[model samples]
Target chain A: MDNRPIGVFDSGLGGLTVLKEIIKVLPNENIVYFGDTARVPYGPRSKEAIIKYTFQAINFLMSKNVKAIVIACNTATARSLKEAQSKYNIPIIGVIEAGARTAAYSTKNKIVGVIGTEGTISSKSYNVEIEKLDKDIKIVSKACPLFVPITEEGWANTEVAYLTAKEYLKELLDQGIDSLVLGCTHYPILKRTIGKVVGEEIKLVNPAKETAKDLYDILGKQDILRTVNKDNPIYEYYVSDIPEKFASIGQQFLKRDMDDVKKIEIQKY
Target chain B: MDNRPIGVFDSGLGGLTVLKEIIKVLPNENIVYFGDTARVPYGPRSKEAIIKYTFQAINFLMSKNVKAIVIACNTATARSLKEAQSKYNIPIIGVIEAGARTAAYSTKNKIVGVIGTEGTISSKSYNVEIEKLDKDIKIVSKACPLFVPITEEGWANTEVAYLTAKEYLKELLDQGIDSLVLGCTHYPILKRTIGKVVGEEIKLVNPAKETAKDLYDILGKQDILRTVNKDNPIYEYYVSDIPEKFASIGQQFLKRDMDDVKKIEIQKY
Candidate 1:
């Protein structure tokens, strides 16, 4: 049984959704979570910048002696996950593969809808992965760029959010998609609003749950799962910017007190 | 006459709105504009990070042999403008000063409203500046963080934007503000929507226009104004990330074609 923490990193606070699931699946495992808040929303950045930022995140997590890493952000996963896996020895899992797999299998009409940030849609990572799983599954993709900000603003369930979601999802609904993938980590937080827009007919697949399941399977299969202990497990939070704002917004995603978040200079990594 | 270019930089495409005014005011002058697209949205970041980024932007602009520099982003200006001015030899101007001056003088009821990003509002630069100009003027400020993303998503004039404006401006409207300062660069792009929400009774002060006037006065007083020449004047655009995205969004902000945008590694500066 290994005790080294599992590291999870995202561009910002959105990854806490994935971290919440990770904590549930691997309750006794130590965890190190990093949020690059200073330079976030990697959605509109160039591929080179995303890859560079992803490597920096990996380097920071490696310094914490993590056994494995999870790229909780779809933009980072789509743009840099392969490069990160090739460069590091630790088992690194990204959200795109599990999300694609879930969407490919869940769709009854064989037409799946993928909505995420501009970078994720442009990378076509979900399309590639979903197509590999089933050649017949058609994909309809759209970039809902405003959803992240809307969620972060705590307007996830507001009329503004509903309208934005309805506008973004109308095209996908028109395409007759049976399943919709919440491709970006932040998208899950707006699930209720999104559900109202799509109604009960469309199935929503949140990648965080699938990613956590994948991590759990990998740790168990590799014989690296932490031994269950009654003692309180360590859970550390680090951010590039000040922790006050991160901790405040983080409470929304985590649904728990974020009291001991530390600040780190991510670029130095 | 000094023929050197005027350098204007913002966190992203938002600054193109300011650049538009700079061009109109100083049509004969060469211009070099930089947008830190890779690390845009300095609003939620720490003060230290904003200062570091502002310095990097300044260094990049200085390298281009600019005669003067404008801190076109409100977050950067509020958090780092003074520090930047002290560190650099070149004349540097920020949006806060002109915005505060305009709001303080324009308000007949002595109650002015200021709206910007979280960083700008928290910095309280506008309040401090306006207070210095007229202690009697009551300043009401709010940080509308989602407006940037809404504008960048090209939904500035949409129903989503209208609802968002109504929600954000309701507090200021209740406070009985006679004039409002569009403290953030991106807010000017949503002027029509914002104006519609606030109505004709409330005067809107776009800092970009006042900032251009301030620059014009400074150049004239210092005897550094560029002489008019029928020859083609240079206007270069630089960003930290890829140019394609910046160019596309920039056209909306600029209201003209963005044909020549170059990418630079801003961190190196």
Candidate 2:
């Protein structure tokens, strides 16, 4: 057992979904979550830039003596996870692998649909991972660019979300996919809207849920699970910009209060 | 006469609206447009971060020997215009002044509505500018955070856009605004839909139009309008990240072919 905190970072508030799951599953574990609010939506950025930003995030979290790092953002993970794992000594887990594995295990018809940002969909990381699991599996990928904004605006269950989801998932649904992977960190929040659009025929896989379990398994195996006896576990959130806006939007993703948040210059890391 | 190009920069592609207006009004002026694609949404960032990023954009433009600079993004202008004007040697113009003046002039009733990103609205720059023109003028400002994404997705006229616009503009419309300021650079793209929601009675003041005219007046007063007589006037476009996606999505904003776009590391500037 270890007392060092676990580090988790995402492009922005979307990662709070992952952090929320992490807190729920690992109740005693202290988390150092960083949201790169200054330069978010890593979806449209270059792979090199994403890797650079991911390293900067890792650098910041490592400063707090985190035992492990989780790349909570699908775009960041798809663009940089392997490279980061090769370079860092501490075990690094990315959402793509766990999410893909879960989809692979959960699917009965061998047809899977992926919905995410332009970067993650275009990266084809989910497709590659699922294909690696089974050569005959069929993959359908579509980019739902407006979903982030819809979720960010807290219209996840609203009519706008349903319309937008229907518009984006029409083709994928028509393709007869049995299981769908929410490939973006923010996608999980829109699961209800997405489920409504796809109906009861398709199963939705949230990477956050699987990623939390992945972290738990890895921590237990490595014997680095937080063993501190402190009555209250503190989670620290660092953002590159204003913390109030982060806290407000973050509440939507977290579904809880983020009482301890700080504004830091991420570039300095 | 100064033959150098006019520098126009925004947090992202929204500035293309301003550049489009500039192109239509002043066809002879060579233009250098920079979109901070990597750090696109300055809307929720801190003032310090916005100022820093704005300077980096300014620094990059200055390197290209631009004669004057236009802060085309509302968030950037709201956060850093005054500081930028004081610090930079070249003439700098921001959208807020021209937008406010136009709204002030266009409104039959003193009640005006301003819609923009969170940073632009929260800064109270539009209200302050309009109030400076007439102390008794009533201003209703709303932060339409999802507008940028709708415009970015090129869904300006779609049903989702209509619904989103209806949702955001409901409060402003109920407040009985006679004239509305398109406070953010991107808001002009959603003009038709906005007009549809607000009806033909409420006049929409586009900052891009007024900003272009303001540029014309400033260039004439300074006697620095481009006098170069090349066969084809060059409009160099620079962005902080991948140029391919910018060229594609930018066509929606620019409504023209962008054959000369280059990727630059904005952090270096």
Candidate 3:
């Protein structure tokens, strides 16, 4: 059994939501999370830059001796997941596959909606993965570029958020999608607003929970599950920018107080 | 007369608003612009990272032999203007001084409102500059961090934009501001929405126009104004990410077709 900490890497703090899920699923496993706060919102950036930055984050996590790595950011996953799995020796997991699978299997009408950052949507990673799972499953996707910033601004429940959500989801709703995938890590925070806009009929699939379950299964399959139960599993947080800012928003995302955050020069990786 | 291009730099396409004004003010001058689209929204980044990026952009412009440089981004201007002026030999200008000066001078009731990105507002550049211009002018500032992304999404005139502006301006309007500064470059694009929210009584100060005037004055004072009128003054655009994305949004900002665009490795500079 491997007692090494699992590494969680995101372009920013949105991955805290995924880490929270992981903690719930693997209570005894240690976690080391790195948020690339300096060059965040990988949404509008070039694919080359996203891949480069993703590798750097993975390299940093590898140096920390993580048993496995989870690319928690959708843009990073969509752009660099395949290459990263090939490059790293450890079990490298990305958010897209599990998310796509869940949406593909759950949709009764064979129509699914996916919303994410520009990079993730344009990559068509969700469409690709879902199509592989079921060729007949029709996928509709749109890039809601403002969602991340709106979430970060803490306006998730405001009128502006509702309006923005309605504007973004209208097209997908018009296409009669049965299931919607919250493809970006940050999108989960705006679930209430999105739900109000899309109504109760459409199932909102959050990849964070499914990803955690996938991580647990993979660890067991690889015979790397932490067998011994610790009184307290250590959780460490590292960010490339202000720790205070990360801690503030992170507490909101994780739904718990976080004081073990530190700043690192991520560029060195 | 200096025939070299005048460099304008921003975190992303937001600077094109400022560049458009510069083109109007100095029709005969050649222009070179660099947008760090790869690592944009400097609003949420650390001060150290902002300064480093600002210097890198400046260095790149210097390498291009620019006669002068304009820090077209409010966040970069607020964070690095003074240090940049000290580091570079060529005349360096930032958007803050002119913006602050305009608001400070135009206010009728001595209460001026400032709205910008989190970085710009938190830096208190406008407040500091306005206070310096006139100590008695009461300044109220709020960070509307979502405006940039909303503007970039091309929803600047939509209901979402109106709601966002109304929410952000509520406090400033309640405080009875006589004049408002569109402190971020992207904010100018949302002028119609913002003006509607704050009403006609409160004059909106677009720093782009004032900044262009400031640049014209500085060039004349420094004996660097372009004297010879070329029928076609060259305008070159460079970005750290996809040039096509920049050109498309840039055309909207500039109100002219942009064909002279190139991609650059900004991290190297």
Q: lDDT of each structure?
A: 0.90, 0.88, 0.89
Between prediction 1 and prediction 3, the one with superior lDDT is 1
Residue A108, model 1: Cα distance from true site in angstroms: 4.4
After superposition of all CA atoms, the RMSD between model 2 and the true structure is 3.7
- CA error at residue A152 for candidate 2, angstroms: 1.9
Candidate order by lDDT, highest to lowest? 1, 3, 2
lDDT (Cα, tens digit) per residue for candidate 1, span B112-151:
9999887778788999999999999999999887898788
**How does model 2 do on interface RMSD, in angstroms?**
2.8
Q: Per-residue lDDT for B35 in model 2?
A: 90
Q: lDDT for model 1, please.
A: 0.90
Could you give the candidate ranking by DockQ, starting with the highest?
3, 1, 2
DockQ of model 1 vs. true complex = 0.49
lDDT, candidate 2, A89-194, per-residue tens: 9999999999999999999988899888877887899999989999888999988878887887788988889988898888987888999999888888988878
Show model 2 residue runs off by greater than 4 Å.
A1-6, A27-32, A38-68, A83-90, A223-242, A257-269, B1-5, B28-32, B43-68, B79-90, B223-245, B259-269
Predicted structure with the largest lDDT when compared to the true one = 1
Q: What is the TM-score of chain B alone in each candidate?
A: 0.96, 0.96, 0.95
TM-score, per-candidate, Cα-based: 0.85, 0.85, 0.86
Better of 1 and 3 by DockQ: 3
Q: Candidate 2: lDDT over CA atoms?
A: 0.88
In candidate 3, residue B190 scores what lDDT?
A: 96
| Ten contiguous residues minimizing lDDT sum, candidate 3 chain A | A240-249
